[model samples]
Target: MTDIAPASPRHQKNMYMRQNKVLKDKVESLELEVLHYKEQIDKLTLGDVPQIVKNWMNEYSLPWEIFWCFEHEKWIAELDNLFPYHMENCRCDKCES
Candidate 1:
């Protein structure tokens, strides 16, 4: 096999610069794609309550649960308003009304 001459430093640097540019561009594009997917996930979860919050709600009783609902009312409504199934057997004065 014939030996090839090494590339000149200027040519090597130019090639390296081009490769660096390509890698940078690829990274930027991937970052944008990640941001896009994150936005999509956020949109899909916009009105969703986290499972941890659900579990926390399940761990409490009437007034405390109502307090939790009131405290988080900015992101959620009263517990009964959102989860009528659990409220079906509730005897709170607010629910009785």
Candidate 2:
């Protein structure tokens, strides 16, 4: 016969509490990181940018145009063919003359 010593109820509760605390800490840390990333994205889209830069981007083209530019090289190449002159003239806010 095997002698098995089960954990006491108090010990099991303590272990569960400790595991819960660790999980909570990790979740809080991940939430903080997500908040920081959201702040960075907000800065990119709406804050931190100068008015002149915003004006330049507004003049350049649609949001999808820029999104597609970075999203896929193949799309850019196709766009380059369809709008060769416009593509040549297109510039991001930072690259605007």
Candidate 3:
């Protein structure tokens, strides 16, 4: 007859600590990924951006947001040869040249 022993309190606490640390590490990794993506998005130009995205940009109220959408169609080929040249422009108040 073999007897199984339950985990000790210290062993349980160590397991719990290990799990918590893994979750925290995952969260930190995700945060770093988000920061990297934000940096890339910051470098993106309005030119060649899709009309669907441009529409949202025009609708946005923030000036910088609108500027980021400025020079719309500058990357014309990005339209995949589907969208018209005049699909959308920065119509925001701050869009004036």
RMSD, each candidate, Å?
A: 12.6, 9.7, 10.0
RMSD of 1: 12.6
The segments of candidate 2 whose C-alpha lies over 4 angstroms from its true place after superposition are 47-97
Which one wins on lDDT?
Answer: 1
Sliding window of 10 residues with minimal summed lDDT for model 2:
71-80
Error of 1 at 85 (Å): 35
lDDT of 2 at 50: 47
Model 2 TM-score relative to the real fold: 0.47
Q: What is the lDDT of residue 72 in candidate 3?
A: 48
Per-residue lDDT for 42-81 in model 3, tens only? 6664235566556645664333343343344122222222
lDDT of each: 0.57, 0.55, 0.55
Clashing pairs in 1: none
Q: lDDT tens digits, residues 1-97, model 2?
A: 9999999999999999999999999999999999976765654566354454345457655543342233221122223333434665444433332
| Number of clashing pairs per prediction, in order | 0, 0, 3
TM accuracy, model 3: 0.44
* Regions of model 3 farther than 4 Å from truth: 1-3, 45-97
What stretches of model 1 exceed 4 Å from their correct place?
Answer: 49-97
